[model samples]
Target: MVAEGAVFTTDRTVPIGAIDRWCSALLDELAGVERELWLVVAVTLVVDVWLTHVGLQHGLQEGNPVMRAAIETFGFAVLGLTKVAALGLAGVTRRLLSDRRGVVVPLGIALPWAGAVVVNATLLLRL
Candidate 1:
C-alpha cells in the first residue's frame, strides 16, 4: 500500500515504504543545508579576518573607518568581537524571518565576506 509522506517518482515498481524513507532522508539533508549555511558564514568571516590580519601585518590599511579605528585603538582582537556581534545579529535575523527563509541571513553575510577574502587575497598576492 502507498504510505504517508511517500515521494512520487516515475518508477512504479518502488515500494511506497521505501519512497517515504527516501523522502524523509532527503528532507533531513535539506534541513542540514540550512544549518550549514550558517557554518559557511562563520567560516568565511574567520577567513576574512585572517586575511585582513595578514594584510595589516604587511602594511595594508583597513578601508572601513570604524574597523580601522577599532584595530588602531583596541588592536586586531576587535575583529573577533565584531564576528561575535555579527553572528548575534544573524541569529536575531534568523529568528525574525520564517524558518526556511532565514538562509538569506547567512548568504548575505557570507557573500560579502567571501568577496572581501577574494579582494584581500588578491592584494596580498601582489605584495
Candidate 2:
C-alpha cells in the first residue's frame, strides 16, 4: 500500500550471532589485558615484599592503617592481599576499558606503585 507523502519504517535489529561475536572479541581482549596485569601484579608484589622487609628492618612507620597493621603482623599475607587487590582492580579496569571509559584506571593502578618506588628509593638512600 502507498500513500502520497507517507513515511515508512523497516526493522533493523542486529543479529544475535553478531552480538555474540562482538562479546567474544571483547572478552578476548580483556583476557589479554588480564594476563599482562598478572605480570604487573607479580612485579608489584616482589617490590612490595622487598619494601616491607626494608621498612621493617629500618623501623619505618606506615601511613596507611591497614598497611601498618599488615606490616606489624604478617608481611607475606599483605603481599598476597596486594596481589589479590591488583587482580580485582584489573578486572574492574577491564570492564571500564571495555566500555571505553577507563581513562583514569591506568593512572590509578600506577600511582601506588610509583609511590612505593619513591619510598623504596628513599629507604635505599637512607641505608
> How many collisions per candidate?
0, 0
TM-score of 1: 0.71
Model 1: per-residue lDDT, tens digit, 1-127?
Answer: 6689988678768776998788667655656687787888888888899999999999999989999999999999998799889889989988998765566677788788889989999999999
Q: Identify the leading candidate in terms of TM-score.
A: 1
TM-scores for all predictions: 0.71, 0.52
* Residue pairs whose backbone atoms clash in candidate 2: none
Question: After TM-score superposition, what is the CA distance of residue 58 in candidate 1 from its true location, in Å?
Answer: 0.6
Considering summed lDDT, which 10 consecutive residues are worst modelled in model 2?
A: 98-107
Mark the regions of model 2 whose C-alpha exceeds 4 Å error after superposition. Answer: 1-42, 96-99
Worst 10 residues of 1 by lDDT: 23-32
- Put down candidate 2 lDDT per residue, 94-120, tens digits, no spaces: 576754334335445655775776787
Native-to-model Cα distance after best TM-score fit, residue 96 in candidate 2, in Å: 4.3
